[model samples]
Target: MLAIRLLAEPERLDTLALPVRPARGEESRPEPVSVTTALPAGVVEEVAALVPATRLTGAPGETYAHLRPGRTPGRLLLVGTGDGDEAAWRRAGAALARAARDETYITFALPDDASPAAVRGLVEGLLLASYRFRLTDAGPTPSLTDVDLVVADPATHADAVEAARTTGRMTALARDLTNMPSSVKNPQWFAEQVRAAAADLPDLTLRVREPADLAAEGFGGILAVGAGSVNGPRLVELDWHPAGATTHVVLVGKGITFDTGGISIKPVPAMKLMRKDMAGAAAVVGATLGAAALRLPVRVTTLAPLAENMVSGSAFRPGDVVRHYGGVTSETTNSDAEGRLVLADALAYAVRELKPDLLVDLATLTGANAVALGKRHGALYSENDGLAADVLAAVDAAGEAAWRMPLPADYVEYLGSDLADLHSSPDRGAGSVTAALYLREFTGDLRDRWLHIDMSAPSWADGDDAELTGGATGWGVRSLLRWLATLR
Candidate 1:
């Protein structure tokens, strides 16, 4: 764990000025720009002149020049983001993150006039951008170790700074868990790891539901998904209820410890990365732990449907319809599409049983999402504008890549079934939307207030987000944490 020391004063951020600016066409030079936005235009001009550029000139996600002095060891990064809007702020953060390498420390000299939200957005982006997952013996952990934020009032930004650090920790933990092998992080092992992480936290309760409990609770999705594996399955429940929480948030994650595609087996190449199928669940547990550690006032409950989707005589087959917790029967169209089956039961239980104020489920549910957003961004689908907007704002503030995707009403026809209440998958084209639509059914009317994150691309990355060293990137933890902090 790397420690980034933050302070509210400008002394440290200002004292490290370079003597000479890097000239154009200069290789290995630092680009230093002053961040300016709607609220901080004055400081932008001031910092811009210092870099021989106008602070108000850099476009969002753009940079002006590098500050490479003769004596300084590190370069000064000048990131351009439009007026301190949340989107621009997040872009600036992404710019900084993209500029960092694993072994070095990067510092952001923020505009003194920016709002507290903008400052939070900037730091959140940097931290998320700096993340990396190195679980194998391939090489050492990433070098981008520390990030320093030079702000105006450290006291005023205390809450945001702590929130960012906590979120970063949670995301990192998720990445570590996702990067491990199936042999090490099987269903039972993963649940125990989550338990161990939460044991020392105050006011936090952890429960692991075995197959019997799942069966008793009518969680057929989890049972059938894990039934094929020798390792079995688990339902991990984590709860945090602070003193006066008004909004109760429920997060259900699809934790396929390893997915071999069951009886409708997948190609050998596809089976290799099934271990990371649990990335969504790992993300939920990590976010839950982060919220509790931060002691956020919002009541939080995270349900992870943990399992191993493998092939065996016991594995559930395609064309089989299983009744879920809320009595909804789903015709399994494709055994490979098992993530939604497990999530269906979990989401139904969360809505009908827990009746939370808001429900959000994260999963690497489809390769379609990956095809749509590539690895740079995660697709977000929501039936509620207000809730979706709030989540978008949080994602913007956190500097994680996210884009709003629609859940078309007409697409509901894709999930129609002849045998059961619904079909697990729609016929091919626009698969991502169909998957979102399928999950929407389990939400009932609550879908109006619900949000679905198709994290198929982010959960597993091949180093596309330079910060992530080609493994589990711990994608959603930071966004969820930042959102929880705002509720508190």
Candidate 2:
């Protein structure tokens, strides 16, 4: 974890300077000493003069470096913040952290016009970029141990700073869980981790249901998916409720520990990254714990169905029909589409037993979502306009990208089956939408209160240089946390 602190005095430490350029058509050189009150007396002027000939355009994620070589050894990193908006500040912060990875201590000089929200975004980006996951290897650790955010008024921004820290910590935790190897993180292992993480939170209550319990309780969908694997399935239910909370929000996650596509078996290249299939469960656990850590007034519940889709003689296969918790039968058209099968039982149980006011389920369900929205955004689908609007607002505020896709009534026809009530369509087109519609069958009357997030695109990154590093990005945690904060 990155150690973060709030500094009242900027002159105390050697810092990385973020200097915003004047807008186009402005005066070439403003007063050096009083350009803006954001920085210490002459910091901006010093940087501007050091690199005079080169243009100091304040584009987000842009950097310029200056080093003094005499008796007074010092380094100044100039970062750009175009428009100085929250989004720009976030990118700038990430760029600054990545650039200064060799430094032991660094401080960010906040701009004069920076809002509390902007400060939050900056802190989030800094901590996220500073993350390094090394469990057993004796590799070189991150040089950055301490960070200070130099603000104009620490007293006024205290709450926002704390919120940002909490959110960053939770997101990092989710990423760590998702990045773990399947050999070490199977169904029972994941349940134990959740139990231990929440054991100390006084406001949270946890329950773990093993295969026997699931069998008796009629969670057929989950049981069917895990039948072939040696590691049995488990359902983890976590609840956080404050004393006077009235609204209830339930989150369900699909935890396919390692998807071999079951009997249908994926290609070798696709199977390599299937360890991250449990990312949705990671986000659910992270968000629920975050709500409890913040002690939000709203009640929250998380149901994670953990399993591994492996190939064996007993494995579920094409043409197999399984009945869910509420007796909604589904024919398996493609065993590669096993995520929705596991989620079906969890959603049915949440609506039937938990009876939440709002239901949001996240899964890396379809590759079509990635094809439709690309790798930058998750696909969000829901029939409820008001709920969708609130979720979209939360996504914007949290700086997590998500695009709303239509759940047209006509899409339900694709799920029709000759043998069972429903089946997963192998249609390459709109695969994401069809999967969401298939899960809708088990949602019962809570369909209007339901929102499904297809997170295949944003859950895992493909490269190290991107804003989100390669591995689990913890994509949904921040937005879900912000949305939970909005509950009355």
Model 2: number of clashes?
0
Q: Can you give the lDDT of residue 365 in candidate 2?
A: 92
Which stretches of model 1 miss by more than 4 angstroms? 7-122, 136-152, 464-469
**TM agreement with the true structure for every prediction:** 0.81, 0.94
lDDT of 1 by residue, 1-488 (tens): 44555545332332132112233344533233333212222433444455544433455555433444553323445566565676576556656666555336655556656666766666656666666554456865556666666666667777766776677678878988888888888889998988889987889988899989998989998898888888978998999988899999999898998888888788999888888898899888898899999988899999999999888888898899989998899998688999999999889989887899889988988888888988768899997888888988887666577889988788888787899989887785888889888998899768788899999887877755433546788888878887887885
lDDT over C-alpha atoms for residue 484 of model 2: 92
Give lDDT: candidate 1, residue 182: 87
lDDT value, residue 194 of candidate 2: 95
- In terms of TM-score, the best-performing candidate is 2
Across 200-274, the per-residue lDDT of candidate 2 in tens digits comes to 678799999999999999999899999999999999999998999999999999899999998888999989989
- lDDT of prediction 1: 0.76
